[model samples]
Target: MVTDETPMPVLFKKSFKKLPMWDFEDVYNQDAPLRPTTCAESLRNSEDESFRKAFLPNIRLFLHKDNINLTEWNRLSHFNNPFGFMEYKYADVMASVKLIPKPKEPLLLPKPGGDGCVRCAVVGTAGILNGSRMGKEIDAHDYVFRMNGAVLKGHEEHVGNRTSVYVHTSFSITTSLYLFKKYGYTSVPNDEGIKYVMIPEAIRDFNWLEGLLKGEKGAGPYHNKWPRTYYAGQYNESRFYVLHQDFLRYVRNRFLKSAILNSTHWAIVRPTNGAFALFLALHTCDTVSAYGFMTEDYNKYYNYYFEKGVKTKVVFYINHDYMLEKNMWKKLHNSKIIRLYQRTDSGTGTEKPK
Candidate 1:
């Protein structure tokens, strides 16, 4: 017997979806004339097999002794031009992503002898977290991760007193470091900050810029800074797996390759900021909860809670497809895989399924 407490299974009708042919082709077969099964059966079987085989365990390639040979070789591929430019920049960009773990560093905070599920709270600077007295609830978790230009001072009474790691881009840090210091926002401790979660896209265009920010010869600008940095690698192989490059490629090849760039109602942000953070949490922690993402009523609040006033929807500048994100979130919510915080008008509390 199904009770009110039990969530009803959600079934998405294909008719309601607006995906194009190519997007469907990558995963679906609209021209399977030789198929002997129903469309649904064919889709399910094909998808099952593809998903299981998609992520290859090993891909070995020859590299030059000088390491410059591959870079020259990559410049020749069709992907090397526009798509090719993404490879290195993606690497540099990911290195700064905070949620990702350094190549082989030990877990920053091992529990009293290393026992217990690692608890992580990913905080976004949304109006939802504004006045809600969730600081205790948020701090109660073992580790906390804040992202972008997060301002934590004024909301302290409501948002609680816990900040383990801060993920930020060079742009965010450079432009706002003085404010963080001015507002009493200390750099998250080096031992605890897990710095460099967000990498700047500009740095990838110049080699000297990369050296300046990350090189260890001496402190350039961000070298040895708080929220220590890291680059992304295989899921189990690296300390953390960031989805920025991976997700950006997926959207480009899978969703936006054919569409006119920046022509749609929404722009798909590269490195999928929130999704990357969530992916890292999913891998790092046994359980995770995401708050302050774009909800159905997201237009009602400002981008950062620190700004007092209604949020005005700026035109989409990045590569994020918020509509697609909304659908994916709904599916995840229905599957009970993660919880999305529901904001109320009063900002006193958050709602989740019991």
Candidate 2:
């Protein structure tokens, strides 16, 4: 169970206790142009080849029946553990739901152009996007990934309108509907080619998948009122995907390895939904760029662009070590593995671009 009061381990206690300090000047700077910088040359010159090579495998991003031996379900059961540290019997769940088979080719394989690199943008909901005017830039990418309450109706100028993929958990989808009118989440992007990526964070997601596959909001958490229109009318099996458990575990262990995972508070130390989407792009795209994610001056922006009132500081949730994730993004940026959009005194600068 995720709780607001969960304690951080002693090793991370001090780091977690530092209150956010806002950079009001940077937040209000409207003339800043989004410039991208690359560290590829420097990273290549560094002696971290092995450190970088370990992350090059696409299999580290996800587990598919084609890539892993599903027959060894018993030995792999531990990977199916949910965010709350509760074990799930994926064997029975997998048998019940006829999952869409993994695509033979990577979804974001580069097409023949500009060095044949597949450029991707993982858009977050941070408040810094308010006047960033990054829409056209984001849409220019070969693929775009979004999640949660991605409000893009009126703010298309700040955040792009195209969505190649939308990632979410069952709870996120249901809650978006519950707060649709209030939060202005008018619709999930209805582009015909947009794929829905499911993060099976809990048992309810399994039930939700069954409902989605049947084309009826079957009996489950949504009480039969789950919107059928949210998904494609004629179900295309290829468009709906459930993230593999092993992939999620690999990410937690390698990239965002929070100290809390070793303590009794392990149940609360899962990655945020944003981290999952960002890393997913890393493996799928030739070049990945993250937008509206937390930065060193995170307190300068609102939690979300659509939020109204005095700028609210980003909250430190027990379920996510956001600081650690922020540092992870920085490290990857330094390694030229990802391009992270960050605020600079002069303007916005990104990790080394190709």
Candidate 3:
């Protein structure tokens, strides 16, 4: 069992020993065929050639310090259209606004590059993904990004075999490395193959990184041992825009006053760091597929699995609510805006999903 008293690495191993495997066959084989929502279909259908030239020119605009003027900010704010409006477009604006030493140029592509068409899989670690066998399918995408306490080091058969990106928060890194050391994932991968996406959840944490390069110490408990430079998505703001912002900027401005934000459920759920990373990836990549988010059978599995007897519930220290997460997954599943693998009961009577 994953006990607090267990030795470091052993603890992680024990905790992950219970990592669930997925059943891909059951997910895609349901009697009911998956259907995309009108809104989602609209986004995909519009991603063609003529549409890109006419509508999303600025999607690739690079706004670093030298040219990142208020005039530019204000000008870009007014650049909103019916499809993607101000506030929604403003997330990348606000996030890209503040930079320390300043960036050389923006990271937007001149023309969408990489594999004739770019497809990505943004995998989340909801308990529903426990036994999901979507690894091969998830890996099939051109780019695969996974986030937040993802325990895939030893469970490759379930989550997938490759990862191009791993988003991490300081707190999560410390916590996971400490708690699940037994799983053999003793440190966050900082190697070249996997890029680290940093979310500035705390201002001090952000400043601490800034201070390191400045030759200052005692920034905080954590120290930077890696080279300092523009880590692709570092910014003061969050990386996610709510549906209201998504619709207002990406759909139509009239939606600015829509009631979606007022949904009691929407109010209850706060955006997650992983959500921000996924959206950021979407803006950069032409196509995206979402995996491992909650499915209809969430409660069946605990919010997360620490160990058979260990009591570590996947927490909500941030604004995100599990109930809201519940609804978002359902909405995404129903809309088919993104594909969510489903859990299945196998012949061995073992729990399975993909």
Candidate 4:
């Protein structure tokens, strides 16, 4: 029912206005079980070939401004403004940073092997992982990507311990530290050799990036001491990478393309941090399996697995079209683009199209 003609907020108003907010009691009720539609079934009935074709060509995974150069940057910047299209300002920020560290060697996106497929797992904070016991399965992949409040101490039995990549916005990194005890996120994933991918979701992120590279607090948010402990390990060039504004714009235009972009609320149409992480995996890895992302039965589970007894509903903030994201995930799964973790009566299974 979500079409380009219908605005994202209007769709939400029509479809989800009356849905009940989850209560604490819902967590104790064992009657509700996951009943996800099988990927095979969805693929068999899919009619959106045009959508698939649109995003298949250019999967701009990482932003090495050196490779993209200023010419391409200008072209893409004018094409569509991802984060409000302040190219001159963005360039200024980039130029101000003296040493922007890059990975010593490029990411092993195409692993040296027969098929050269890099298997990756993109983990979200959804509560469906509570008793899934998928920890071992998720960690078995070549790379594991986690974002936001990725609390792993007590829930390692379900969420795994290996974190190859930690994706975050400036807000998420600072907020995670701020709300450490409240959300039960004891620590951000600080394993040695782990890569940090920063999504430049706002101007604050650019400031934070400059501060991080300079090893000093900036005038922007997080003016307090930079939490260097979370980024443990020798200062290496390869440890940090920022998402390009052009790539983000491409994602919005090709995949999400929410009607909010054309309306007065252009800010709200931008993709969520989780969507950025998932798409990052899709482009970098040959095979991607998303766990804890919003499923069709998203309302049945809490917004986060770390919330013990409070069955909080996954809030669809004015900024994100969560329903549209859910549909995109489903479509990608059906098209064999990525594996979506789906819980059914039989147990948890990765949806791979035939």
Candidate 5:
């Protein structure tokens, strides 16, 4: 299967790996104990049954040169096929990532003063944030997470301009500009030294990573131009990260697994990219606040924060389970695992443009 001669470091992590390796050494327990930092996080431990679960600290969260192997490739095929038929082999992907530095899991470094607090803001693209005036509040967090078609050119006041981690697939990063140009999406956020995290959801993602890390034009329909140009000139390996395959499947299998999976369109059904970004923060940060995500009154606001003119509905496609995500987010918010930003019309159940 491996076709290249590129030297690789020994990947200590494995599928469903339950032992703490390099990045997770400071935060793991074999018994799966609850190390809650805030009063909210203390409410739900691994032993809790009524609520959805967070990724255990022992689980390998990121994929780097030393954290992936052929065995992992086989085990991950069950969740979402990354490269079963593509010409791109694990060897090629590894060769590309070999250039990256070690321990890419925790992008945020250690907390200062040993205060043991890491606060994060997971900002979504839902229209609820059109005029929320939450930019200052979001920026107050230690780190901010954004995903998918994040339109932030003119709406900086609503959704804070900070993008500590931007999680996306190759397709979303490449196509988001043209897809969201109607609302002033000229470029993806390029905050000073912002960390870029890739979710390897499909073959195209692997293809994109292959060409991206090598500083070359990647194969595939969407990748006509050099993949590096999409990042707006912030393509250094030290600031880049790839999420592990098992982490994705773990999220789907445990938290966001929908009834839609039992149907024929199972392959297409998965949690929203925003959901993934939110959970990643939950596992890493000591405290988390979610903004612009789906809520019970989702239909009240426009589909996206950047949309102009009339309000639009949150369109549902077969590929994603929006309702399932909404319920789970509500549960997590209620469970004190994360703080969700919410605003209502005060019993009127009507839309009032801000």
Candidate 6:
């Protein structure tokens, strides 16, 4: 009964109430596997404020016509101004947004099955996974999430070949195709029944979204490019989702609030895309395992799993706080919120990945 009146923390509860499944296939192309309604289904009754308050589901997770109002727009605009900006008017963005299919509450699930939990794996492109042989383990989850420069051709042996959800912004998706071209990267992963989550970081994303949903000619980064052709595979409108601005701001304010946000460069500082992908799974899935994220020993490996150790250095940029991300991932892992993959070896671990 997730309705407009669903209380605060709608996603967290002692147990999830069941929902009718008239057209289950409309949500996912696969058979509905039974999953508990709440992500932490087993600990639904936990009274721990620290854990329960960490994720506030009452705030919209995905953008839909019904969920957003004038007030919500004004609130969200205080940050990156996702709905509108100087580049585009809010009314113009809504024209295309109106065409987007409104997903019902309890989205992207495979249908509840036998009170089982929905397990997910969020895979990053860090070099630590290059030789870890974690492909089999990563693909075993109910859903696999990947983002940014995720080149999985020959290295399928290490990084799993499946991608249930691909999270990206206009910049990441477009730049990845160009940057990873040498590593056999062709297009974004498009598995049957897969979902695409777009993070509208700026006005360009809205322009791209407009082009995508309305078949309009793209402006900005993809000027003159058809949004559909910009992608590599077939996409279904029903399966696509745009992340709500509240969720993005929530993650930054609560978990990974870096020191940079206080400085003049605060506008430029934000969590990595991988961080958003991981958090998305945390709020949506029953169980989450994070792979290829920054760890304490990040310096021991190359910047990206696909890059050669000698050829590229692990460049630390102002856009993201790598050290803060590493510590937060470690903290979350230690807190049992997520299972972060960390490799322990005997050597300095500078060995080239096979």
Local distance difference test scores for all models: 0.42, 0.64, 0.44, 0.64, 0.69, 0.70
Q: Please report, as a residue range, the 10-residue window in candidate 6 with the lowest summed lDDT.
A: 20-29
How many clashing pairs does model 2 include?
Answer: 4
> How does model 4 score by TM-score?
0.76
Ten residues in a row with the worst lDDT in model 5? 24-33
Supply candidate 6's per-residue lDDT for 252: 76
lDDT of 1: 0.42
For all predicted structures, in order, the TM-scores are: 0.56, 0.77, 0.57, 0.76, 0.81, 0.82
Compute the lDDT of residue 295 as modeled in candidate 4. 90
Runs of candidate 5 with Cα error greater than 4 angstroms are 1-55, 82-103, 345-354
Taking the candidates one at a time, how many backbone clashes does each contain?
A: 21, 4, 19, 3, 1, 4
lDDT of 6 at 283: 68
lDDT of 4 by residue, 1-354 (tens): 424332222112122222212232111111112222222422223455765455443344455534444443333333222342333353444542334543433444544453545678999988777677889999998899999889888778788999988888778877786675776665678777788887876557666766677667754665775734456553344677777665576576677777665565654467888998888776566668999998987777767766666467777888888888999999888877778987774432221112
Model 3, 20-123: lDDT tens per residue?
12232011101122222223333345534533433332232222234444434433332222111223333333342344333322222222453345567888
Candidate 6: tens digits of C-alpha lDDT, residues 1-354: 323333222121112222111231112111123234654443333454676766553445677666565544433333443322223344756665566677644554643563456788999988787678789999998899999888898778778899988999988888887888988888889788778888877767877887888767776677777888655665777878888766776777677778866555655677888988988887677778998988887777777777654735577877899899898888777777788988876332244333
List clashing residue pairs in candidate 4: 102-237, 102-238, 103-238
Task: Give candidate 1's error at residue 206 in angstroms.
Answer: 6.1
Candidate 2 per-residue C-alpha lDDT over 1-354 given as tens digits, one digit per residue, 9 for 90 to 100: 312333211122223322112232111101122122232432223455744654534453333345434333433432324421125444435533454466433555555545555678999988777667788999998899999888888779778999988888878876775674565786667677787777878667767766666666644565565535665452366766667665676677667778876665665568988999987887666678899898877776777866665656667778899989999888777877678887654332211112
RMSD of candidate 1 to true structure, Å: 14.5
Q: What is the lDDT of residue 29 in candidate 1?
A: 12
The order of the candidates by TM-score, greatest first, is 6, 5, 2, 4, 3, 1
Q: Give the TM-score of candidate 5.
A: 0.81
Candidate 6 lDDT for residue 186: 88
Which stretches in model 3 have alpha-carbon errors above 4 Å?
A: 1-115, 211-269, 305-314, 346-354
Error of 3 at 1 (Å): 62
